[model samples]
Target: MISKSTIDQVYETARLEEVIGDFVQLKKSGANFKGLSPFTDERTPSFMVSPVKQIWKDFSSGKGGNVVAFLMEHEHFTYPEAIKYLAKKYNIEVEETQRTDEQKQEANERESMYLVSEFARDHFQHNLWESELGKAIGLSYFKERGFEEETIRSFGLGYCLDHWDDFTKAALEAGYQLNYLEKTGLTIIKEGAAEGESNRKFDRFKGRVMFPIHSMSGRVLGFGGRILGNNKKAAKYLNSPESEIYHKSKVLYGIYFAKKAIAKEDNCFLVEGYTDVIQFYQRGIQNVVSSSGTALTPEQIRLINRLTKNITVLFDGDAAGLRASLRGVDLILEQGMNVKICTFPEGEDPDSFAKNNSLEELQHYLQENSKDFIQFKASLLAEESANDPIKRADTIRDIVNSISKIPDTIKREVYIQECAQIMNISEQVLFNTLAQIGQKALSDAGKKAREAQKAFEVVKSEPVQEKIDLQYELERKIIEVLLLYGNEEEEFEDLLLRENEAGDLVLEPESMAAKVYEKIFLDLQEDEIELTHEKFRTIYYLLISSLSENEDFSINTFLTDLDRELVEEVSSILMEEERYTLHQWERKDIYPKEKQAGVSQLVSETILTLRCYLIKKRIHSLQQNTEGSSEDHRETLEEIMNYLQLNTLLNKKLNRVLS
Candidate 1:
């Protein structure tokens, strides 16, 4: 468990915008920050962060809370893990108690796998630095690759011993479970034993140097290991098998280190392999990541999309590799991102080129060599189709198909013009080809939609519109008012029921001065009312007690003590109108009334509405009871009449006309 003092300090020191900004790119909007929803696939900005309130809301997914909550949702960190991450980010010392054996065993399966992966990472790093065989093999290989010690350590590069069960044995001895070890693909198990014999186990990355693959928040999800010796029987690069924690297609190498730089530069340098990413980053190019030797995936592209709209793919001069990577450029275009391609000299790849050139030379080479995707594709294809009319025509259609993948019409048209100029083809011809491809794509999409509809046609019906829950809404409003203005002192117009000279019931108005929370509490208590919703009820009492007790209360500090569910609830209620506020209505010549200006009236109206609703409910219940009652029917009728009259008087005082 983390000490409360440390957690408090972390909450105080860590800024919500700064923490979430590491994962999602945030742009300033009015008094807050808005960004594309990291929790959802969105083209528009709906994720909001309020630094003043220290809470965030994602309107797209409807997830909202404070800094710690964002980490838990985005990074999948446990509460303690989130606090530790914040502590590490802000350079605060975390005070935690040592977990007992039972506590350690209490972790869930996914967390257990994470713990095992983390342990394996540390064990491998220790082997690389301290073990004799590791220093002679893994350390020597990294050194020969021109990776400095600091770079190696920063990326958490390590080594696994050559012996089959060396890593497996070490992990077992360190109190790590073999089940998790096997699940994480650290220890591969083969079952081919007789009744008395045990299943065989061996290290998955034996005789290899380790490169830890991390999530965007820097958790060790898996690893990419490269074999050292000439092993013609084995693959050169091996990755951890798919587990609950690691999916290769969704994982990018060096993203944790590159996210900030990518967002800062507003561009990302995408490469092919782990070494390519490491070499470029070591040479002071920080905004770079790799697909880890796999073909580029849409998932990986979306990862980079979260940070920037520009991707410059770095390729070596191998002809086959260059052709294979052109498909990724289309994928980037489909995502509405700008893409450029840069190739090294004919004999070099990114790793070798960066090793040979100084930082200035490497940076200058990229600047001079990078070409827009369309220009590069046109020139490359134009050469391939030289003096062959059929091939040239096919190439034109191919380029147009790629252009058709772009979502932006203006960009597609601009690229079409550029293509015409480069290939000496008619712009009209290219546009016609683009239209055909787009039409076919739409036709295919329509077919799929119709097929899907047919599948659900048997049970499909019009979606039922849910009726509004008035009582729940009133209860929610009361909580919102308390959260917003509970501590505020305001003069209120108090109403009392009295008998007039004409012997009729009337609402006699009076003046009273009290805190907003005090007036609300007294009104609710007088009516014997309680909130119907469980969450609102809990928060109501919490707010009433806290606001009444503390003269200097803060929502930020108060929220720190609640669990994530309640925190999300409170944030949703508090920021319900944030979207409107973000629009700056006054600037559009639409002056909206401010909530703060009418705090007293808002409180009184909310309580009066609740009272009216409860009275109507009571009257309905009493009328139902009198319908079938055998005894005391007249008494029940009188009670119902009295409640109806009181409800009418309350509504009239609230200026609500009865139908």
Candidate 2:
């Protein structure tokens, strides 16, 4: 419902690099930014972001699109949601047309859950700030923990009322559905078995201080609650049960606040608790997030890896916790992330230490304390071994094994040297251990891959393949021509589509893309059915509207609008891997040439030329296929003449280019 101007503002303001740079650490790769793929598990970066095109393509996952499209695909934002996100990012005021009550009432269960969670957060905040009990108990607790009012508001922290059913009553009176409240785990619903009432709803986090868990894009996913009241049998901290909108394993606390800083710093600090992250950020270290309580997952590490190659694990100095957390460092390394370990002094956690120091002082301490994972591990292990050769040797091998997980071949070599320096072992011995573990892992992976491939073959079979008719080739070519040469002016002797469509087709046919599409659709209308190829048909219709409906005729825009599979195929065709022209341009000292113009222009032109050629070839083929069906000489002669004329026109255009 956003106004046209608002939508344009969102799209225009969304700089591709700026938007993507919030999540991925991008280094300039030619004119584009290249970084590790966010879509897949990969070490070497094949993802490319083009500022000029206002789009990005992940060669690994084959997902390519404009900035809004990227957010939609990567972050799962709906189209309007994506535009609003961009608008918010750029701090632009948005103007959206109001939806009707019926429209608003049609909220899906997932969106409804999110709505209820957001309301619960607001209710808690109001209590924290306005109510006496909340200020005395809940708000005081956060302050006692050293949280500033701004930090509390920024994190959306709040207090659930100590009275049971207080939240439940307010939400129901506000016309919010009780079903959504229960579904979101904000309220507990019990169906009547022996009770007089059919249903009962009560606040799930009553008497608790709230931590609103957020997705990277800052959407409220669920809540984590810390009990404020003394209940002897109750646990101190509890999280909302898993719901459709909240998956604990996939969600990380503080990511919403930390993502931008993480990208800016080109590193992420992994800590263990909500306060740990809040304290670090409060201490001017903004690029920090906590696993919240889950054992370190590859998924969690991969989330960090998307932003940066380097990660620093901040652990408490407890010997048991430090040892347990070291295993998480291995997970980071396996994702090709460089890791360092920093443990605070015994009896002191990040929250206390940071509160006691200024930002600069805290940063200085971090810089001095941070040690390369290999060095830290060796030192810690050596102290534990105490000259026991077997344990020492085992520690060396374990360090080597961690080193082997680095997917970058060059990095593996560098880490091997570090391993030698720290453990005081021969580089050859460490290298030998790395190779042994790496080879075994790869062999095991290969065996599993082969087994999966065989299983896939047994379960699935090839569909009845559609033979590529000449028309299919022609249709594709026409689309290509329209996209590339649509804006160009051409002096044409035969503007056949325009002439024939003097009545029904009122199109001005401003661009080559439009003209070609109009001509083909007009010509094809005589056929009994539309294109048999479902994907092709969709593209065909889309291309027609691309020209007939809009004036800008942006190929990148069109590519973004298409379905994902078609978008990938079209983008790969458009973004040819033959980057020789780009390399050659670099040698010419073009000095920061604009991105995608040269590449996309060339692609668009090639498709047009191919299409014009194929259209004539298709008419000839079709004439031949239908020739024997009609024995009448006059009808046959007329068809032959039409085919010849189209051929002559096509050949002339082809010859001009090919020559």
Winning candidate number (TM-score): 1
TM-score of 1: 0.94
* Tens-place lDDT digits, model 1, residues 1-659: 89999998998899999998999888888788888888887677788899988999998888999988899998888989999999999999999888665675688888889988998899899999999999999999999999999999999999999999998998888777889999999999998668878899999999999999999999999999999889799999999999999999999999999999999999999988999988999999999999998898888888888889999999888877677679989988988899999988888999999999999999999999999998899889889999999999988998999999988999999999999999998999888899999999999999999998888757668999999999999999998888878899999999988889998888888999999899999988887887878999888898888998889887887787788889999999877777775556788999666566488888888888888888888888877777765786877787887888888898888888999
Supply candidate 1's per-residue lDDT for 271.
88
Separate clash counts for every candidate? 0, 5
Candidate closest to the true structure, highest lDDT: 1
TM-scores, one per candidate: 0.94, 0.81
Candidate 2 is scored at a TM of: 0.81
RMSD of each: 2.6, 6.5
What C-alpha lDDT values do all the predictions have?
A: 0.90, 0.76
